[model samples]
Target: MMHDIPDSGDQPHLPTTYASVAVIGAGSWGTAVAATFALAGVDTRLWGRDKDVCDGINRDGMNARYLPDVPLPKGLRAFDDMAAALSGVDAVAIVVPSRSIRAVARQVAQHAPAGADIAVLAKGIETETGLLMTQVAEEELEGHVVGCISGPTFASETALGYPTAATVAFPFSYADRLKPEASPAARMAISLSTETFRAYVSDDVVGVEIGGAVKNVIAIACGMMTGAGFAENTRAALITRGVDEMKALAEALGGRRETVTGLSGMGDLTLTCSSTTSRNMSLGLQLGQRIPRAECFDGRPVVVEGEMNARSVTDLARRLGVAMPICEAVRAILHDEADLGQTFAALWARPIEAEPNAMDLSFAHPASDKAIQKLAERIA
Candidate 1:
């Protein structure tokens, strides 16, 4: 069951008033978040490492290189100088690729405004540190309040204002302390609006972070099945088993098991696996079709996060002695160490076990079973 966070007696539809916000990347996701804040009338500045991309957003009000068709709003500003972009901002969103999160966090430490709330939207585990995005923030930005926003969000869709749901996770204590600043407008801007797109806030930062990181790899696995023309049974099995793998990793990392079963875990895996827009899923589809990985991504601008995450996740799982067969199979395929048939065989050959054992079974009890039964009936 999801943990309930009592509304801190703040209006649910108000947007927080901030003097200025800085977005520290100009990739598609970064662009969308920056656009949203800019549309909300926040004095938002976006920093891109590429000079040409920055110039394009500043001059044409569009990021032709990253997001070609979506025109940025008039109020948004773009800059190539990271320090200048971060100066005096009330909040900073780090949207760099997972591989570069540490490096970017270091840069933010050097110049970001003191006491700014650092928000991490990037998803994936750091290979070297075996840390999630929020953990990286804690290590790099010691005093700042850190938060994460993640779910099955598609950047292109979100940029166009297509409704989507995601979880905003921060410490409950920190969120409680920020109650005075939480205006109704802030709540409206971030809250769940429709079934199509929503944002649920949670205090389980560890669970949310793990779900976001691990789902990319699982999505790739599902995409491979789709490309291979697998039947519905296969898809069902893969998704079910994938959740188990994700939960194991989450538990190993000190996250609540229930959080994995929530939006970031099961919800994210299901959405990414089924969606054609997911980069990792697309990459897996290509792999399933016998296309060369190098050729498939030959001219692509955005990196497939799953391809990068698979190795890091696999290494961490092994070090923790956690059974993450799905991620292991993905890593093998990426490294050309296992053929498609062998990978699938490995999955099929695993000894059958009860579903609850796939998760941290300690959370399971008689009452929990009753709750799950009721939830299942409701969905039915």
Candidate 2:
């Protein structure tokens, strides 16, 4: 059970802390999130599929496999039993690979505490369904508040208590604390935000999801440029055009235009595209250097969400009637095995057109908006 928030004389509805939380993965990001919660004095449980990982974390107070050299809080416990981890947990932060989100959601739906708020840190579109991570969660965790988070922090930096910021967007029902019964998601956000890590709230869940998902593919393209001996101008051009592509898709999918320019969008895009530490970027570097795909990531511990989402994102863009050239190029290179030189040439050879101002929100998608509203109503 979560502690009831005491009514502050000035702000009566804010929760200062959460009682318990479960981070549903043992990956570096998951371990870091669980550590944050535990250090915040919340009872936290980390659930991993591997028994050995759980045993190690419990025994050593560190997830040596994922977050080497980073000390974990004593209050943070690890469990292989999903049910045990969810016991008395108020919120669940899922940090599994994008490909595994649906399977994990199925397990969570069966075992999660009733009314627990759920958020996913995984960034990818479902290959078969083209659904976002939050959408998949909503499918399985019916009637539960489902949210998605995205932003610029690397797991390694975050685990060291370095400054980090993120954006978390939920369905409209959970966007504001209109009613105490409707505040579970808001409470989860408050508990997750700390001095070192900050989480800003939003109602544009679709925008946040799209931003997080597409940025990885863009990062791959940037990495390819870097590995191909391209100058900074080439990388800058890709990043700029990538933002336009993201904006177009996000707006087409009923997300606000401004959302794509915020923390989840531009912030995440910049970080992933520029950082060599990014798994997707590093994978792309290998690809650009002509390394076999299998060999590039053969023994890597992390799953490059960009590699998984490249095709799915391009497919989604086509389905939504949105143009995402950079993302498409990445898919062609990665999935279709197109030659990098040819792809780059083709991209540059495309006809030049006047750029549309992404700031303008006049383009309407009533059907998309209505569908999202209906979903929110049904779940609410």
Cα-based lDDT for every prediction: 0.78, 0.82
Error of 1 at 58 (Å): 2.1
lDDT, candidate 2, residue 369?
44
TM-scores vs. true structure, each candidate? 0.84, 0.88
Strongest candidate by TM-score: 2
Listed per candidate, the RMSD to the true structure in angstroms reads 7.8, 9.8
Candidate 1 per-residue lDDT over residues 66-156, each given as its tens digit: 8889988898999999989999988888998888888889899999878787879888888887888888878889888788877877788
lDDT at 140 for candidate 2?
Answer: 91
RMSD of 1: 7.8
Q: Which stretches of candidate 2 lie over 4 Å from their true place?
A: 1-10, 174-182, 297-302, 357-380
Please provide the root mean square deviation of candidate 2 (C-alpha atoms, Å): 9.8
Q: Positional deviation of 353 in candidate 2, in angstroms?
A: 1.5
User: Which segments of model 1 are wrong by more than 4 Å?
Assistant: 1-15, 174-198, 298-302, 358-380
- For 1-380, candidate 2 gives per-residue lDDT tens digits of 22233445755556546688899999899999898788777899999999999999999988988899998888889999999999987788899988999999999988888888898889989999999899988999997789987889799898889999888777754234445324544566677777788877777888998999999999999888777766589788988899888888898999987898999999999999888899888987777776778788665665788988899999999998887889988999888978776676566655545657633434334354444454333322
* Worst window of 10 by summed lDDT in candidate 2: 371-380
